[model samples]
Target: MNHQSDQYYIDKVLDGQVNMFSVLVERYQSLVYTVVYRMLKNKEQAEEVAQDTFVKAYKALDRYRGDAKFSTWLYTIAYRKSLDALKVNKRFVSSSDIKEIGEENIELVEDALSCLQAKERKQIILDSIMKLPEDEAAIITLYYFEEKSVKEIVEIVNLTADNVKIKLYRSRKKLYSILHISRNEW
Candidate 1:
């Protein structure tokens, strides 16, 4: 691990030692890739987006002010890139499908999930999260999986705190619904 702060690496890169940029990429690639994979739900597309994210960040490194944490800024870029890809892919969710996963269904699945092995439960939750719409998946992944604060998510997704909270609520319902439907397959 690079003991130096992200700013130190950023400064090194900015000073023309571009190799320092690779260190930053190595540091955050998994984080960026995870955000993209959860939203895109495809390993190949997520890999492409993750690469593009670093390239874009390298080019735009000069414009980065010290306002947000480096991870948050990189996340904002990753989130936007995922949106662009989703717009092109045009994935949609059927309301009928969501409707099938009713309000009461969440608790039933929650109970069943508690009996699952830790790794199995986490994998199930992650798989269910991937089934969400792009925006919802991103919001939920940032909030729950990445443990980002509402304000941090607001900056990453460019949503208001209230908007992030509302999406978090809706995403959980949809995730539980998806889980309920998929439960029988396990």
Candidate 2:
């Protein structure tokens, strides 16, 4: 596997070396699919959206200004495309009735999950996140799994910095609440 800056491939693709685009896809395919899956919560739909994300990126590659990291730009496309998928499919679930998480923060959830095997813990965490609304799910995936900063998330989600913070905070609280319930269901 050769290592090269993302821009190196982007430059090559722009120079009419179309096959170079495969390198970018190979680099980001999993992450793009994961983010899409988290938001859509349906493997088939997420797969379509993820592929569309790459197609859109390829078509618009020339518009990329190199201001943000390539991954961030790709994520922005993934996030929006998933939102479009949700709109088209009309399956988005809202968490408005989910009563206050009350007393169950992520720390407590982590403690509860400590007994599970690592794989189970990770899947449980991902499942709990998938139960969230699309926006919050995307936020949590970017914050925890991808380690994207608030600024990066803001760019990806097209939200204000403060808005992203508020959503991230509420998403954490909501996530722990979901995990708390899951623990009890076991």
Q: Best candidate, TM-score-wise?
A: 2
Instruction: Highest lDDT: give the candidate number.
Output: 2
TM-score of each: 0.87, 0.90
| Model 2: lDDT to the true structure | 0.88
Scanning candidate 1 in windows of ten residues, the lowest lDDT window is: 99-108
lDDT of 2 by residue, 14-36 (tens): 99999999999999999999999
Candidate 1 backbone collisions, by pair: none
lDDT of 1 at 115: 73
The list of candidate 2 runs beyond 4 A from truth reads 96-112
Write out the backbone clash pairs for model 2: none
lDDT of 1 at 59: 99
